[model samples]
Target: MRSRSTLLDGRCTISRCLPLSLYRARTTRPLENHHGQTPVRKRLNSDMPASTVSSRHFYQNETLLDFVARSSRPVSLRQLAFFGMKLTNDKIIQSANFVRQELPTRMAHRIHDMQSLPYSIVRNNHISYVYELYYHSFNTIRRFPVIKTVDDNDRFCDVLRELLAHHTAVIPHLVMGVIECSDLIDSKRMDNFMESMLRSRISRRVFTEQHIALTDAFLKDPNFKPTEQVGQVFFQCSAADVVRQCDTLARSLTQSSHEGIPIPELVFEGDVNTKFACVASHLRYMVGEILRNTFEASAERYQAMGNPPAPVLVTIIDAPQHVTFRFSDRAGGIPPEIIPYLWSFVKGPRSMIRHHNFKQVPVLEAIVEELETFVAVARGQRKRISSLTSLTTRSPTLRLGMGLPMCKIYAEFWGGKIAVKSIEGFGCDVFLHISKLGNESRFVQMNNI
Candidate 1:
């Protein structure tokens, strides 16, 4: 192998004793031979292990950061130097540029495309870029002398905004999309007529299909007796089961809705159900909203591509230590510019804010009529419209900006926290963490839905 200098602790020196395997690794660039195949370059890290890549867990529990982290694996200096030289390959560089350009185009062609352009690459690319950036940041940028400035804070904010626009937006979207998708799939829509429809449902087939005892509990307990006495109900949903269901639904929907877009990848650690083991109706609604946004976003991307909806992956970690969830997507990741204000209802990209999906409606008259009705309602309470009835009739559009905030509130209320991360041109990840139920197991538990 040819001799070369290696950078160690910010210093460089020629070293001949460096491992030859490292040189061989460098010679190949990306160490393709180590695994006997071209390493997959992932754009995002779904909340599962990379070894568990599957279309079933496509978007449910993935994040762009995980992809970045996985991509940043340590390698020998010879490999790094060789890879750096290989990066000069027109084809390698072109592939990167191709992603940068094609992603934005795909995004712009769809609503909220700006948010999904980043998380498309496979894992290796994500890590490589992160590693390269780390090297550059330390060896190049850090070497510059620092100077204090009165406007430093403001400057930082600008940089932060820029970074978010360029890096973090998709992370949360991936997270939000995954958890929400799983939860939504797990949700069984029970309408007002459900009771009347199921009144005669005590067939032997039903008994054989489900846990009869659990069914009896729901039928007997006033809390879930399908009566008016139940103000609001709560339940626990299994994360793994939810992932399985979402996969089924996404596949069904994709086959029926659009042509066929490839689904995103998903990966995660631990368990999802153990976090939100017990769930409330409000939390379900919140989860629905988040999933609705995710689905809508994915659907829009599919439409833009003139392809069908793709598969999605959702993971719920029912870990004993911390119950968590991961959501990932194949539509790349969110744009960096919108990360800070992603859930803030602040103005989005001008193109999105001005693009009215309901453009055909007469806005002026509609607003005036809406305001007049609002004032009329505010002046007095109506006796006829029950709160529940009104809630159903007046439910806000699922795409409204309230989803994340509502999810945060519900997650926090349930003794958990939510977080997100993304890669600029790859994908995104969202994580929800809740206090674990110490020594608790739902293995034999049955949900009396």
Candidate 2:
């Protein structure tokens, strides 16, 4: 037995020692404080019976279950999902659905208690914890030596009860942690995605500016001849044709300036002009955004460490089903902690370079514009997954913070679907689907900014 302090309503009372596994580490320190007080930490393991006087005291005063039972609370979907995941089987989910369908009543106070927590918090923390716990329990059940059969034990039920008790006991703390996670994820994803978009927009602006400059040179110089140009002069067109094409098939792009950067083997299949509509430019932008982010991230690291430029490998596979692009940078690899937040639009661990002068590109402005394109596509009401033709695509762009979300929105906007897979130490792959619209370039004018 070890000596311990008792707690009630967040206050602690000094008392004679007792032996408890949870309190064994505190034996060396005196129980009494400067004011002759004892600070009792929350206890995890105690051998006392449920009927003991001290146990009763602790249950009545320290446990949050009582507080929740007495209050009017609201339940959230996330908690319900967590509970569902922790429960014995499909029955829990069914029971929750049944409970949810009914109005709040004294008999269903637990549901009400659950509803009291904010939604965002639950996804970030509570859901994550519940998932983690469920996964751990799943592993334990699988590996345990004593298991006679899957149905022989009440292991799942017991763990679920423990989870519920923890939530009820420290509802506020759990809720707060969940909310913090939501905020962090949201902010991070948004920042990273937005940064990627801005970079693409900047690149597009550079391309457009160069195109205009070339046109002016062609007009002013006697030596400059468009017909004699070395490369494929489009294999076609007039300035008017180019402008009309820009309005329709022009692809907004981000690509490596270095010709040596190898393209990796990533591709998609489907009627490109049909599914994406007039959004081909935007789609390309999304793809470019992903590649640019990977390339830039790698390049910046090399620059920081004073290493020579390391080439990135990128590839594209196009078929009747979809268009896919894959990009790989020599910059080590993405860190585990940042993976979940990789495609978010929030600022990352690495900060962007800021210019002291006003003339430089406004990174934030570009991000907002890129994000706007996605928001526009997502906010479209006519879109749905049912409208898309089945297809598969792979690209680094799909991993951009807003890329997948936008791809989902755009695909679904026109009735399509999206999927993604990634190996943290290796790379990421994304898939998108949109109904074939038969090559009609769909364009919506941006409101004059």
Root-mean-square deviation of each candidate, in angstroms?
26.0, 23.9
Question: Taking the candidates one at a time, how many backbone clashes does each contain?
Answer: 67, 49
lDDT of 1 by residue, 1-449 (tens): 33323222212211222234332312223333232322222212222332221121223222222222231121121221122222222323332232222222221212111112222211223222322322222222112223133232223223222322222222222223322222222112211111111111111111111212222333345243322111122234455554444443333333333345444333434544342334333334443444444555565666666555444456666555566667765555667876764643223443233223222111211011222232235446443421111111111221334356445544554356677676764455667665433222222111111
Best by lDDT: 1
lDDT of 2 by residue, 228-301 (tens): 22111121112222222322211222122223433222222322222222233334434444545555444445
Q: How close is candidate 1 to the true structure, as a TM-score?
A: 0.34
- TM-score against truth, every candidate: 0.34, 0.28
- Name model 1 segments beyond 4 Å from true: 1-236, 241-276, 306-311, 346-390, 393-398, 436-449
